[model samples]
Target: MHYALNVYGADINPLAVLISRVRTARKVEFAIGAIGASVVKRARADRRFGIETTLANRDKWFRLEVLTELSKLRRAIRSCEELWARRFLWVTLAETVRLTSNDRTSTYKLHARPKHEIDGRNVSPIDVFSDLVSRNADSFAFFRKKLRDANAVSHARYRASTDIALVDNRESKKCWADVAPFDLMMTSPPYGDNQTTVTYGQHSYLPLNWIDLADIDPKVDTELLRTTQEIDRRSLGGRDPVSNEEEERLFAASTTLKNFAEALPDTPSDGHIRLVRFYRDFQASLEAMIGQMRQNSYMIWTVGNRNIAGKQVPTDTVLSELMEHAKCSTVTMLTRRIHHKRMPDRNASSATMREEKILLLRKR
Candidate 1:
């Protein structure tokens, strides 16, 4: 068996780069799976790219098969798009509301909706659903025609065709863990043990119910397990410690949490210790991520500081120190005055925070 090396030379086409990267990513995944070992821990211990080599010989065949299947899946998603988009509208709106309360913060009173309201403009859930549902109809025929016309100038087939490479690893930690070193790492780490900024489980329920997106069962990811542990404080509407309620509606389990906490003598009485534990846990995860990165890789982390007991715990500053301690070189710290779309409403007396400090760290 022979393999063709994908290289972008001086006569480069943008599409070629995308297709080549997609193909390379797929081959890498097959290689990792074929290794039959924990690639992550192994990668940390020893940088190995052999699995990628073994799969490259059959890369072309695999790419063609996967793309054909993806085209069909895309068609199916388009077929039921109307209902899919409509249902996604609520889910998208719910996503705008960041569910922040941990199981320990649950209360019996009406939960105050955060002040942050999201603007759903042109690509609203309704529009997405409508376009998807009417894929076969002539309604979007003009748009489709225009798209095809715009894409026709290229002589590239594989170059112009972009693909998503999904590798199924039974021992992966996060959703995109197997995805090799990305050119850019832009993401927000989980905030504390509370689900306040957004309950990953709750916000995703709408998308899961309506859209035909890939299997993103949060339960499948071990990183999400930490979230489940945070929300598993008390049983809802029952005396038992466990309840069979879905994770998305775990906020409704707040009342049950307050009851459980009130019953405990060492529940910190003021909720300060919980913050400590949460931040500490977050720092640990960040360290693990640092360990996984290639040397000199950049990490963009966006986090905010909230008022707790009238003392501002500058998580950004604390995290900076932690990152440096973890051997991550401190790059420029960028402070942006962006509003937390889910910033909670504060009383006249409570201290309010309205900005996030973006930290850029480089792994050494």
Candidate 2:
């Protein structure tokens, strides 16, 4: 069987080179499925690609044959011996979904899914899986090294408190919570909801559909993939757009958001609502995170400015303002250029983004 090698160019980050050197070289091991060319052709005729459903037309981006073969391969992997190895194979399969699709973008949460005129974007399951197997070997090696370097030993497992409003709920020790404050934190929060910005949920949807939840972890929520948009819906701005929500407190919290809302054009009211809902939810999350940090700790906030209604949303500036309200002063801000990303690039708003902002802050 012939397989193509995807070689990365020198344009990649220098850190990637360092990680590659540290990763212990190892042979890529994988379970070879009985899915042959004939099996693939047979599956296409077998009809599982939603040809008759409302989603039938999506075949333009995701060919029926490719989808069926992938589905067949994934479902069969569950019966394979060595549960841990099987789970890893399933993750590799999920990672290859975007690669096998006809869409130009490698990632999803499209803001909106686009229809491609070209019909040759679909890749065979064999090729996609093969490429992923090769990639995973190196990826895992680097991950192990990183974990070793960070000394990521197991810590006490405690489910996050369900209610953000309960900051002083004195029952934390009873629940075996990690009341010990964190020394530092670094996170790249979402630019907005998955539906509009990255479509992370949509990108994850196909892979989750193929991966059995029980194999990953018993605690894993199967409900997250119940709907194609379920994860995004559960995320900020995942609900139906409505302008009547009492978000005055949200507007009052950040002058940047307030000013942006006022300047929004009288079109796509849903967009307006999406922005408000996302920021409001984000504010709640920020407050929750702040509560977990030690005094005078360092935090690094990586964010991007997504365009909405043909205007650049001042994310870094707004974060600075919002953090001020949270009592964290911004130490400095830096801009990182995005060279080549797989995210959707067609949307005038939130797509075709070139740079992301990093905000270094200190908790007072």
Candidate 3:
């Protein structure tokens, strides 16, 4: 909507898709402030004491008092008549959960705070939710004002089209085919597998338990919340094992990948296996994306070179080679320094990247 262009996006994470959908929604709720105030008011007046989540060991991550308050908030949000407003409030509730939970805030992983610290801390989910709702309402109002000023809004709705879907890119050809072909593609794919890299699934696991799965997408499976790692396992390169033939084809398509694999130790280590599997899945996703682009279309890919077994994976070079094999030519490569990041400086397996490469390519 910022550029007033029709936009479409897909993500494996349901939470991600929910957030993206709200952000790109064509319809605007001009009464967002009123709706948010009503939610808080209803939550405060309700006296329900039931916990809402069925997540295993729920007490491990939340105190009884906090859980009770969250349950009240959840029920109140559910009473909302407007689906869009409810979705927005759900996001607010999710943020409140992040702040009030026993989980530490420094990292994406769901490690609990020290027992002493958790006990010493006094937080209220209701208060947090109220404040977030107020602040977010103001921010959204400001954004809509800007859009209106730019003539991007008409009759309280975005002028252009927008579509967001919950999808696995490796198998998304049909999804993209449902819409017109795109001329420009831009994405910053995962640096490596989520488990050893960022654990996006784990980051979303807690908040997801609180939000209604049905509100996100009809196809969203509750099984994704079965385990902390379930969503990550369903993500790219998470559970699929690379076959020898597929590996050979991938190697033939990108010599940089072949060289990297050949340089690893003869003894097949878990890290080596993960590296290859991630690339294999990435290749498939790239093919699916390329298939959706129009001829002479341009792609801007931002990639990071992650380390495995103390060796750097030349992701940018490898991606360029793969695109070349798919009949695309690299227009240029640009480097950008990472000034700030949510990832840890280093993990047990490897150091996080300090910079990233942006490759611009065109379909021939």
Candidate 4:
């Protein structure tokens, strides 16, 4: 699918996505085979990176071809100045790779390396690269449109161009150091761990595997790619919280989460742990955001009630408690019907996010 560049305004940073890849322990591999040490060194030195030779579940030749094609494309684009915009374009190519890969099956997530597979009709890497080049201008065009709008606003309001700052926010708990306080802070935190809800890590795995980390942003640490799920795990609730007493106290702070946890129907221990893990980190991140905002500044949270252990987790109510705990008062809570939203339909925990809630809060 094409990006939401001109439509719903999905406003994603490819660097963040790529940086998430870097944050993981997973490193990109070159096409499988003994290209030996020199190629590996070259792959690292050059931004036109390689793929994991150990990567399984795809046509070997096809993977190599894509890698080769990608190398040439990177060299061809070396003269381009629109780094971020071009990274998005490369992401489009990465998407094409996913859509063309044998992994493009009926699975709910892309990480499932299928078993007992056979070759079928697939687009060659060259063909995909050709198609990508034709539409490359569109990527730059979208960025240029945004640039013009930004410049126009600056000229009218301030009589000069404005500087853009790209901060690395892959870490939720860590404080942004020496930052000026904000008049407003608006964000939509994840409903749950990406695993049970969305396979965001898996979605980026392929793209990250193919694109050069340097091409996207040199700051994008490939160390994040230690594992396919590293970013997801690094996310809220991705890990075990502190002491049990602390977890219990934090968990008990939100009656909504506590009640939801209590209502869990015949769940496994991991399911219960996952729920706790999410809200604890969610709580921590919320607290950090509040600390960054000016007193009396407004904050808005648009959250979804994701199903966990077959129970609906009232994220809005939970967040209201969190905001109150963090010295913010909930001004209002509203619900909006979700006529359109993407989710794993077959996923038992997430098949029921048919609506979302909007929570407005004022920092006291």
Compute the lDDT for candidate 4.
0.58
User: Model 4 over residues 208-315: C-alpha lDDT tens digits?
Assistant: 665666775555556556676765666666776557886787766787778777777665667777788888777876776677678988988889888876767778
lDDT of 3 by residue, 1-364 (tens): 6777789999999999988877888996878888889888988998979899997988889988899999999999999888888889988998999999999887888899988998898898999999999999999899888888889988888999898879999888887676758988999888877876778899999999999989988899999999999999988779878899999999999998998888987543686788889889899999889989988999999998887777778999999999999999999999998887866555743374888899999999
RMSD of 3: 1.5
Candidate 3 residue pairs in clash (backbone atoms < 3 Å) = none
What is candidate 2's CA lDDT for residue 283? 72
Candidate maximizing TM-score: 3
- In model 2, which regions exceed 4 Å deviation? 1-68, 80-83, 102-122, 142-176, 240-246
Q: Residue 71 of candidate 4: its Cα lDDT?
A: 60
Q: After superposition, how far is residue 7 of candidate 3 from its true place, in Å?
A: 0.3
lDDT of 4 at 251: 66
Give the Cα lDDT of each candidate: 0.36, 0.58, 0.88, 0.58
Instruction: Estimate the TM-score of every prediction.
Output: 0.44, 0.70, 0.96, 0.73
Report the C-alpha displacement of residue 136, candidate 4, in angstroms: 5.8
- Quote the positional error of residue 62 for candidate 4 in Å: 5.1
Error of 2 at 10 (Å): 32
Root-mean-square deviation of every model: 18.7, 9.9, 1.5, 8.6
